[model samples]
Target chain A: MKIRGYDKENEEIKLAMTPMIDIVFQLLVFFIMTYKVTTMEGDYNIRMPSAAAEPTLTEETLEDFLEVRLQADPETRFLQTIEVNYGADRQVWNRSAFPVRPAPGEDLTAAQLQQNRDSRKVFASLNQFVINIVGSGSSDPGSGSEIEAEIDADPALRYEDTVYSIEAISGYKDDQKRIVKLIEKIKFRDTTNQSP
Target chain B: MRFRRKRNEILEGDLTPMIDMTFQLIAFFMLVINFSEVELSEEINLPMSELARPPEEAPPFKITLNLKEDGSIKYYDQLIAGIDVIKPILVREIRQANSDGVATSDVVVIIRADMDARTGDVQRLMNKCKAEQLENFSLRVIERLR
Candidate 1:
């Protein structure tokens, strides 16, 4: 009887609570460290633009993303003015239209100038280019060839066309940078349209 | 026949250890259950896209828009409701979210609208979102693979 009782005592089951507590604390710490706490405060009436994407930023913050703002078109529903902007590094981009055309009777070198001029006139409506601001004169056609329009792109300009435009420009190849020191607006974005 | 005696005849099966594990499993399932089926029965179909990817994480807030095939807007799974009801709910949600520590830019409002959804409907929603001061968002579409 004494031997049987000893065996029964050995059989009584027990679970160490220490390991369970350790695991719980480990999970709690993991959740806290990986947690991204942010606040969402905005108008609920705005149905946000949805894509299959989670709007990502590779090397920048939401504040640093390029903006192409779209307000309700001030004119007809058919037309919308897009204001484009990139932040600090080149906040003030300048625009200029240099009409380099194929020289009438020239060989390769002169023809290249014509090709270059014919290709596109650079223009900017940004705040950073000192050259466009400092180089104006009577001899230099009063700045319309490359107009320097003011740019105040809204932070909310994260729409398709606007985002596409910014990505096209900001992500543009630097090989073209030397030739594109001046920025040019291909067409004037009409800002005078009446509110929709 | 002569009676046969076997020492193995007194065998017993233990139930406590198995019972303890079963209870742990049941507790786990209870804690892991997601009970919200609020948007599944909308009768509205979300558009499927080839480029769709899985969501980042569950947002503390969201706005579900059900788009009718002919470009009509539905509110809260109800068809063609007033825009007035839509505005305050959105504003209040944003306000409530602010108190909950989610910034306007951090909140993601997922639009589960149909693909044939009108450009105007999409643009109007963007405008409303801007008015609400909510900045960050993404569209929800069905995964082609699914």
Candidate 2:
């Protein structure tokens, strides 16, 4: 007859707890390294303008809209010009043409000349550009009579600059103290050829 | 005289608490981990915007395209060669989005680009998306005051 202690030892099953614990610990480490806590990071959504069919907008009516071209200065590598095209006539607004503070008795420079010459000229602020594109007149405000603006920006332009342009164009209040959306509709023109 | 201890004395401790604590930790990690981070590239630094607001509703279908400062594109954690390579991939994705009877217009294309990325690269990508008739596009930005 086998002894009780020997029989118990033979029948008992042993689990290697150490290896299992090691594996669990490994998994914990993996999760810790790869884990990311999600936050409200992606808050901004921009609608991409397309040539697709829209029930309300027809091709013939869109031909008369305004077009703004943002071109980067090869030298400064910044948005140097704003070319506004209204029915084939192009007016270039130079960034350098915007005024800077002159000395108390300093002679007027080119920028100040442009700023003073044309009441509609875009001054140092982007708001001026917005105003020029969307008429500053408050009369008959909140009416949906304004034409859509098409923005064609160079591919070399920085993302922030483009956002600023978009913000300026989209967020404008009309003269009636009501939100008169000047550039209510915006279409991004494809300047993909400029990309390297 | 010195007393002798018993040779076969069983020494036991409770393992239920240790296992419980470890399992709890595993569950915690799993719950807090975000799988979307895998698709986001670290090279791109998102821009800031004052108007940016958290999406009101979760999009039924969404795909994130990461564009680095150099204009290199990353989709689903893979680097695509150029617009040509990404074209077919987006077409396939649009088809996949429509799998559950959702329209192509309903699919949201999230553009996550570096602040220094060129507008041209983004436009090119947008053109491709437009070609596929995918209209909804969202540009991701960090929320901050102007």
Candidate 3:
């Protein structure tokens, strides 16, 4: 195609489309190499203990709070066990009912340990309890009266284990294919001595 | 006939096409680059959870805190040594939020803690958040790939 209107005179101007297209191709390649689609991070939400003393809850809602205490093994400094206390009832959680591998020198039959590393009876029991008490329809483990969880952990506890305990208590996938947060709110039991 | 060489002639090419292409690339990169990434750090190994899901909408206001396994807390690559260092920053943020017509309570704090960090460190950071009176918070977790 002939190009015009370059100067005041009707000089025929021609664009070097080939070289232009080549440079454009290079630019496109550069951009494609650099483009990155970023997914949203931080999927889990938790409440931090308010600095000021929060107003006291009414007598009715106070009972909905579940206190979960995480204690680390004094020797190993790893999370030893978790204790879940709700009003009058209390439950202690140990390792998975089935062990994948015994610690260093413990003697156990190979058949005694399960292979799945994530097998934790505590998580199962917690899920069942949430289902029974707070889950929807007396069966749905996610729908129930609003319940909040308060976690108290030994200062020596590994944050990893503390997070696992929080996950077991407040995390749940509902039947509706929605993430139904069982523990809508969570707070630390004590913050006075822990401030760094 | 004697042949005469053309004098004072210049060779030029239209630059509009190349400029257009460059601008297009600039637009593409601007759209794809993650702006919020500056808030996070490589030091944190965020925990994974089966129930974790992406937030339905972008948070209205957010401040990301990174806690390393060694118990160091950082905000945007700046280490926060103590409450004294953090309080001023958070107060400034609260004031900024108030200027934007957003309540101090509406701002969300995202804590990205290393999986092996001590709970005490995270609690300390949370205490600071509480002191700032920031109610909303999210703990960064990778969604379990099932």
Candidate 4:
């Protein structure tokens, strides 16, 4: 019995690299096209129950809370002032008081560019003031957790300013690059337009 | 001058390295690509905060409401006209959450308001959520690292 000789020419089996390469390239292009660079995001948790459902607080408990009032400019809707009331003691930070001062050679436009920086500085001051009152969360964790903050923002104030205020009251980084938390319990004052 | 005879030879270049690099890139993109973009709206410019840090653990249930600069609310891809119109939507979400065995209070309502949006509108949105008995809220902000 003579065995059929194996076909010599059919021995070399080459994979079709063209189709795989094409598909791979297509996938790469798809991913590259859909890729987007997004900045890191975070959240500030707040618990606000309805007025009807809210538990009645005693006068002593109310006194323990901090009231933050954010006043806005009527026309421009810019933050005009921030006021923090801790019982009878009150602290106010005025935007106009901290005017943006440019360098000697800087022009108006250049100085105006530092407006945001000035706002940040104002918020930083707020953080400092809050630290003085509640003591740094790192130094005294009990006080920070016990004290709640009630944010009463103007109707027309920019949300950004409100966030900055919250950030100021929330925490601050220390010299050691550690986050020193302040007040964690934050609630918004109900300001729904009663009329219209 | 003698003409050289043409030979039928298949020339191949080594594609192993190129294929390897392509696969690596694909893997990286797959790992890094965020599938939660549906909950975030590009139209809203989030406020920056140094104290804001991403939560250590994601909430069991979340309702993301994107407040545009014009006071309009964006729920997923749908553009809500105003804050008042969002009550029904909240009701629907709460009902859905209830069906999923999640309590109304346990559901986290994430407010992603634009930096320029009015504070009053944000409060109103919060109030509306409160009226629905959904108290938990998370205000989304950009994490500013100094």
Top candidate on DockQ is 4
Candidate 1 vs candidate 2, DockQ winner: 2
Better structure of 2 and 4 per TM-score: 4
Tell me which residue pairs clash in candidate 4.
none
* Model 4 CA lDDT for position A1: 67
Ranking by TM-score: 4, 3, 2, 1
lDDT (10s digit) by residue, model 2, range A1-196 = 8776885776758676878888888888888887765445654454554544544545766554767788875643456677777665567767653223378899877767766445223322454555564564334435433656778887687776666566556554445534444455666864434434
Best by lDDT: 4
Candidate 3, lDDT over the whole model: 0.70
* Candidate 3 local lDDT, A1-196, one digit each (tens): 5556545466665666767678667767777775665534545677654645566678776678788888877655666677888767788877543334467899656555543344456566766675555653234444434677788988778776777677777756657767665665777775765444
How well does candidate 2 score on lDDT at residue A98? Answer: 27
Q: How close is candidate 3 to the true structure, as a TM-score?
A: 0.73
What are the interface RMSDs of all the models?
Answer: 12.5, 3.8, 3.5, 1.3
Q: Model 3, which residues run further than 4 Å from truth? A: A1-14, A17-40, A48-53, A57-59, A74-77, A96-119, A136-144, A174-180, A193-196, B1-31, B81-84
Model 1 TM-score, 2 decimals: 0.36
In angstroms, the error of model 3 at B10 is 20
For each candidate, give its TM-score against the true structure: 0.36, 0.63, 0.73, 0.89
User: lDDT per model, in order?
Assistant: 0.42, 0.68, 0.70, 0.84
Please give the lDDT score for candidate 2. 0.68
Q: Which tens-of-lDDT digit does each residue in B92-135 have in candidate 1? A: 77888889898877776665555444334444555566567665
TM-score of chain B of each: 0.64, 0.79, 0.74, 0.93
